[model samples]
Target: MIQSTDEGLMRLALREAAKGLGRTSPNPAVGAVLAKNGIILATGYHQKAGQPHAEIEVLKALSDYPSAKGSSLYVTLEPCSTYGRTPPCTLAIRDAGISRVIVGSIDPNPKHQGKGLAELRRDGIQVTTGVLDKECTRLNAGFNKWIISGRPWVIAKAAQSLDGRLTRPIGESSRLSNSHSIRMVHRLRATVDAILIGAETVRKDDPELTVRYGPTDHQPLRVVVTKTGMLPIDARVFVGEQDTIIYKDRSWSDVLDDLGRRSVTRLLVEGGGQILGQLFDNYLIDELWFFLTPRLVGGDKPTIGGVGVQELAGAPRLVDVRYLRLKDDLLIKGDLQWPKNPSRAF
Candidate 1:
């Protein structure tokens, strides 16, 4: 059973873990807390990619104090059992002498799936799971999706004026959404692994694509999808070779292979409409997060995606729908429910 104090500490850990977003690329944001004798001892959150994990940092923070031999540990995700950029977190937890472990969610990756829990139990540590399970899963949805699926989770976002136009007529500069909504967009950027846009968006907006607010520790990878690879060399997103990925009409297998090699787990697609249509047409998208404002712009500019289709007679279907009201805006989130046979076209 989890005590109220335990739940409170876990909430603090989750909030701390959220701060590591945008910086902890290729690593799941994790939070850990140690409590002994009804008193909290140490807390830590994963900060960046290729660095020590949350468990390791917490253990280190408590090094000079009393040992954790009889303490309880609360973690956002199951401790890792496989070694990657850092050592397996299970081994570190054992070394800390923690008597009991409470995990929020299990790691879905096959390599270290149940091994971490099994190892802790074998070493005589009492382990409990599913504390705030849904919340933990929601926080790490991107990492979970990547571990289960081959591709990244897709979040599609757009902002438009009261007239529903992303930009003014004749390509004039205009503010699509207010400052509050724009701030929320930046917050979304802080949580995802990557932000993607089409070549046309790059040519027109030249977005910096970096986390500009809150903690500046991490930034998402900026990606552009172009069939002919016509993106400008000096675009703000393309600061160097490492910061950008240009998706061309290459072999599908090759593209997947490259993405695997790069360890790209989650991908957020911010669109100029045509790009969204292309991804949907190719059946490459896994999930969709849509933010629809209450205002409507009846113009010739664009509506989400510009690929003018006469009808949705043969389009993919949404499997689920969720709605959230943010101030005056309506966020309609939907998940694509592909047919039983994935290869079959709608």
Candidate 2:
């Protein structure tokens, strides 16, 4: 049973977990709170990959471990029971003399599922599960999806005019999003593990595709997919110091499989239409974010190219959709109900 105070503490833990979102790749952002008598002693969050997890950070923050012998620890996710880069957190919790362990969600990884809680119970520590479960689960939705599906969560993004045009009448590139929305796109780029674009976009937009609107210690990998290896050698994407990958004449599924093998948990596809169309045609995209500007650039170059579904029922539907006002543009975001692999439940 969880008290109201426990929910509040778990919410705080979730907030702490969010601080690591962009930096923690191949690992879920987890937060932990140590409390005694309903009062928080210390709070911590996972900072990056191959670093101390949330539970270890909370245990290390304690100035006097003996004084907080009966402290209760609240974590957004299950404490890891296996040794990887660091020792098992379950052992640390038991040695720390914590009396109760409340977890928001179980580890989605099949190997770690419920093992941490089971370990804690074996050591005589009181365990409570599923405190603020939905938020905790949603916080690491990309991680969970990757863990279960073995592929990165794909988010397709584009900036388009109200009339659904992606460029001018002559097929020249044009900026449709406002300055604020552009910064938002950059922020989105910073959060994902990689940014994917088509070669046509590279030739026309010539975007650097690096995070420029804000400060970031790491930049997402820039990936360009093309049938013909015809991009200019002097293109900014190739010239920049940041890492970039060129996939020539490869299947989209194969590209995704390779990305998954590289442990990319989140992938953002910013495109010039044909690529986005192929992804949509294959049901590879999981989420969508489109910035719609106030202006209408009437032309044959729409945001999406290719022969779309002939039947209305064949079209994919967006669920849990949201519209946000970004300066002069509207940011429409949602998840696609269709999955790349229909058998996989991501």
Candidate 3:
């Protein structure tokens, strides 16, 4: 498909919208740009929930919206039509006399949905949908998942040695990936609502699980899954952050409900073998991000405590595998296609 120059600009606007990842809970991150005759005028993005929408921010930035009556507006998501905390974005577009609007994707909120686009048509405005749609949809995947499934989209992340081992010998907490990859993991932590690890992992690694990389507006909630509820009070995970949760044994459905109640739309699961086995056994994992390192630990060690499939044919398969080389480590990210179930958490 051929993309126009404006589409490229809209794509950039969408990227600008993603800056508010962990901060924008209960609201999708949106980016907008106002342009006239292929020249950009103003640009803005939704920073957090209850704040002004991207369109409002852009219009506020411009001194005179009436002067740019023939200008085009590019937004990552559909402008809202409802009276949220602020006024409807549809009304603002009409008042500004914007001749054209290019939307990256339709908003998933049932209250508005396509109503914003419909309002634009009523006002004799030219509107376009699906401009760089795939990328835009991906940018707000967490929001969509929460709206549709009522649960956070879980990503099970792990680093495996060349021989399929997850770690080094016992009592030795050596680093698996390089320093660059460690920073990348911190970046991933910044985007999610919470990070999960087994009690064993916390006791073994004593990881702080805080953002030590680039600038991030919000830090994810640190979570520990425990069976005995004997987590150390002085553990590194508990030293600084008070926003930590220690979850006990519960049904997979209830786990999903608990996360939903916490407004954790995006969850990253960093686990040891036993914890990974439990999630996989219940078919609760939504995505997988496994890193393959160059060093090989040629021993009896295994990557994860075998996710009890019972049969070889029933072993989980992660398709659409992609490999990105970070230094010598190969990061393989893929989506797991589990079968349909009563609860969409799987």
- For model 1, how does the per-residue alpha-carbon lDDT over 1-346 read when each residue is reduced to its tens digit? 6766767777877887777755675677888888887688888989888899998888888856457878988898889888799998888888878899888877777887778999999989999888887777767766776666555566667776555455545566655555666677788787776787878888898888887886545577777777887878888887744477777766534554466456666667788777766566556666666565656767666535535334566455765677766677666666676544455232
Q: What does the lDDT come to for candidate 1?
A: 0.73
Candidate that would win on lDDT:
2
Model 3, 279-323: lDDT tens digits are 887777878888888888766646667547667665667877778
- Which residues of candidate 2, in runs, are more than 4 Å off? 169-174, 339-346
For model 1, which pairs clash?
Answer: 23-218, 163-297, 164-297, 273-305
- Which residue runs of candidate 1 sit more than 4 Å off their true CA positions? 1-6, 82-84, 161-167, 232-234, 239-242, 250-257, 300-302, 306-341, 344-346
Q: List per-prediction Cα lDDT, in the order shown.
A: 0.73, 0.87, 0.83
Q: Per-residue lDDT tens digits of candidate 2, residues 97-193?
A: 9999999998899879999898899999999999999889977878998898778899999999899877755565557788989999988888788
Candidate 1, run of 10 with poorest lDDT: 337-346
Candidate 1 contains a number of clashing pairs equal to 4
lDDT for model 2 comes to: 0.87
Order by lDDT, highest first? 2, 3, 1
For candidate 1, the C-alpha RMSD (Å) to the true structure equals 3.7
TM-score of each: 0.82, 0.93, 0.91
